[model samples]
Target: MAIQIGFETLVEDLPGPRWQALFARLWPGYRAWFLRSGAVARPSYLESRRALRQHMPELVPTWQRLVELAGGGDVEARFLSLWCPPPYIVGCSQAVWIDPAGKEEPALLRNYDFAPALLEGSWLATRWQGQRVAAMGDCIWGALDGQNEAGVAASLSFGGSTVSGTGFGIPLVLRYVLEIAQSTAEAVALLQRVPVSMPYSITVLDRRADWATVFVGPDRPAEVTRRKAVTNFQHRIEWPEHARATHAAERLERLQKQVDGPGTLEDAIGALLQPPLYQSAYLRGYGTLYGVAYRPASGRMELLWPGVRWPQTLATFAEGRRDIVYTPGAEAPPDPDDAALAQLLTESRS
Candidate 1:
């Protein structure tokens, strides 16, 4: 059962007051967790608020509202699910399959049917903090697991037995990386310093085209693994058998082979769309939640939502004013479908 709900709206076009009010409603729990962790570099939320005010004055009231919400005790563990930072002022470019023709054909890209239970009031309102942060939310949204504005993208999966760390979860860390860093190198540098809570593998891509995968642990940075292919678990590294067995090494290997042969981001995306590939069946339990593509130059981000049951592709543009496209079922395999996408994959490959 997959629960995914997404909507699209232009950031600049939204009513400023209404948007601020929405954030005001959602901020308490997120701010509480960040403050409780003591990981925030600046101790005072006021200072952070002041800084954001300097550039985005509109968000000041929203920040204050979050403070008020946090004071009410309405925000507790519930808010801890996903606390993403504000959208950084940066460019983004992305692409995804959409029913441009409105053909409802079975496509890999489509809107998700969230479980009704998950749609209870505050949960949906809080989770889909839509136009609130704009660029920053592009990274924070679980759709593609990456931040588009900062030209940084990341994806994470549970490693089960092999991963071990005691710090912030990858999703939060990915948000932090998008907020504070400007480039992939900077993001990697920052990750090296943060105290991670769990053992997980992170693949980060920056605007400058630099990419690296860092393996994290409880004690220290275990290994900075490098590979074009990434999966849910750790990659080729000498760790304990207990760690190695659950790493999903073979999946990465097969993915690498596919990429080496096809050698394009589309190929990588296609490989990711395939079913699980762990012989022991452990890796089978944990598969990809979705796939995302971000284009920094255009400030656009596209999300492909194909979970265990609901398989569809959806696209959202940062600059364009348009409703999200939801395609049902699976379409033809993505083999350089459009010229624009082909060009993007080529450039990304270079």
Candidate 2:
């Protein structure tokens, strides 16, 4: 049997009752996890808001409006930044510009690998018509990855760096870009201006088949490259700890091999469902929760998993949707070399 994950679509204007309901549903767990994490650099609500205003002033009013819309209780904007400090995300792979042959239009494929517990009560899909953006994210009002109506799509991966600083998280950055940027060029320009707290790589793709992958962080100058895919590291593995911990290189190779073989979109997706890309380690919360392919030209999205495929557009998704759960059907043996790293991550969290 296939696991069924429930995804709700939200299309109302900002600060509506639905937004409040979602906040109420997701805030408790989000708060609990934040408390459990004992994040030393977690900013206060005012501090976070100040940083937002100073760096991305375009979003401050919007965020304030959302807080007001969510009933302006005790919820503070800083809670949203809790995950910005580069949590121990071990595996993720993304492919942009996967096809120029027009076999299926250019697409962006990503596997959001992280601890499963972090996503509790928060796998909500949002289509904000007012903002003209469609994204998948949690209660923090940040985007995990999304495409805008302007035919620009962006997705992120941990940049495999231990470097951290007092800057904004990548999820909110993604939200800002998706909401404001219309093309790959625009998105690239916006990335240059933003300040990021942790190392991350964002793959940007526009409807015209134009793409760029940018590696950015608080520690180093941003570097952009025209590429078909990116996984974890960029240029060099600045974080030796992660080099020992992750299989990012192997996953990248898998994607490269598929792309070099002139593989179709389906073939790439198939590779994503296998080892490294599609993880099965639920005990460590590193399993692949979901996989998505975005077609920027048509503003269409295809959700794929074992034994199921659900297609939806921003407009149609609001009318109807399905909850797809990912149940690990088969267990892949753990890589012995990586076991210690996984254990260390689990212990660090504990």
Best by lDDT: 2
The regions of model 1 sitting more than 4 angstroms off are 1-67, 74-144, 160-166, 235-247, 277-288, 305-350
Q: Give me the overall lDDT of model 1.
A: 0.38
Candidate 2, residues 4-94, lDDT tens digits: the string is 4565566654556777777778777666555555645466677777777776777777777777765664434566543354343545788
TM-score of each: 0.51, 0.86
Model 1: residue 335 alpha-carbon error in angstroms:
36
Error of 1 at 43 (Å): 16
- Per-candidate Cα lDDT values, in order, are 0.38, 0.70
Model 1 over residues 1-350: C-alpha lDDT tens digits?
Answer: 23333333334432344444545654543454344534443224343444445433433443344444444332322233222222111111111222233332111111111112211121011212232123223212222244545555554433322333334445455545555566768767766876555555556665455667676655556467665554444544433332232234555556556545624544444555554331212111212223455444334445543332211112332332222222332323333434433332222102
- Clashing pairs counted in every model: 28, 7
In candidate 2, position 191 carries an lDDT of 89
